[model samples]
Target: MDVIERFCNIYIDICQISPDDLESIYAKDVVFVDPITTHRGIDAVKHYFSNLLTQAESCKFDIADVFHCDGNNTARTQVTHIVNWTMHLTLKGNNKHITLDGTTQLNVVDDRVAYHKDYYDLGEMVYEHVPILGFVIKKIKGKLAS
Candidate 1:
């Protein structure tokens, strides 16, 4: 399958992705950064994904749009792809459905991702999903928006 297809599937069920698949999809020194954590190297990236999977009962991505830009086709150089997506996850324990709006920027080198970063609201994705915290967060947001 193509890179975009692979990318979509990978996030849908990160727990199912094998180490070999991780190796194939990311550069050895790939770096990943998101709201909660930053990790470097494919090994670290795999670990982060595994942990994220463990926190959620289910994870899925709704890809809104994908844009690809090819750069100089040379070793060590990368092409860029930006993905605008929504993440739907069932939070552990509470089983609350959390839908977070997000986007990802990927730098691809030799068909493998060399760099990745995700943008999303930590409050919407996690804090606001907590039982007690959810109420407080909603109230705070209401006060601020007024």
Candidate 2:
């Protein structure tokens, strides 16, 4: 499979992801960025995922679509891909399941991801799940929408 497909498959079920798996798809100098933070290098990315997975009872990604522009497919000299997906997560000690829609941009070099950036709403993924904070945020959103 191509790098984009391989990358999507790896994230399908992150609960079982290993450092080796990450190494296979990511370059040693990979730069990973998400809503929470940014990590540089394969080791840092692995460490970030390790900590994130430990707090989750389960995590899964359902890829909705993928778009890419590569030399073979297009005239573009750069290789970049975008993936849209929905993430389902259940945190440890919390029975409540959270679902969030997100998109990721990936830059590939030598069949390995060199850069990755994820886009998602922090409020929808986190703040909306809190107790009092959730209620207040919802109220504010309702007021803004009206």
Q: Could you say which candidate leads in TM-score?
A: 2
Best by lDDT: 2
Off by over 4 Å in 1: 70-79
lDDT of 2 by residue, 24-127 (tens): 89999998889988899999998988888889888999999899856554321244888899999998986779999999988888899888989999999889
C-alpha positional error of residue 96 in candidate 2 after TM-score superposition, expressed in Å: 2.1
- Global lDDT scores for all candidate models: 0.79, 0.86
Which residue pairs in candidate 2 have backbone atoms (N, alpha carbon, C) closer than 3 angstroms, thus clashing? none
In model 2, the runs with Cα more than 4 Å from the true position are: 70-79
User: Measured by TM-score, how close is model 1 to the native structure?
Assistant: 0.83
TM-score of 2: 0.91
**Candidate 1 clash pair list:** none
lDDT of 1 by residue, 1-146 (tens): 76667777776665566656777678899888889888988889878767776787887888888899777665443438899998788868977887888988888866778888889998987788678999999999999999
Estimate the overall C-alpha local distance difference test score of candidate 1. Answer: 0.79
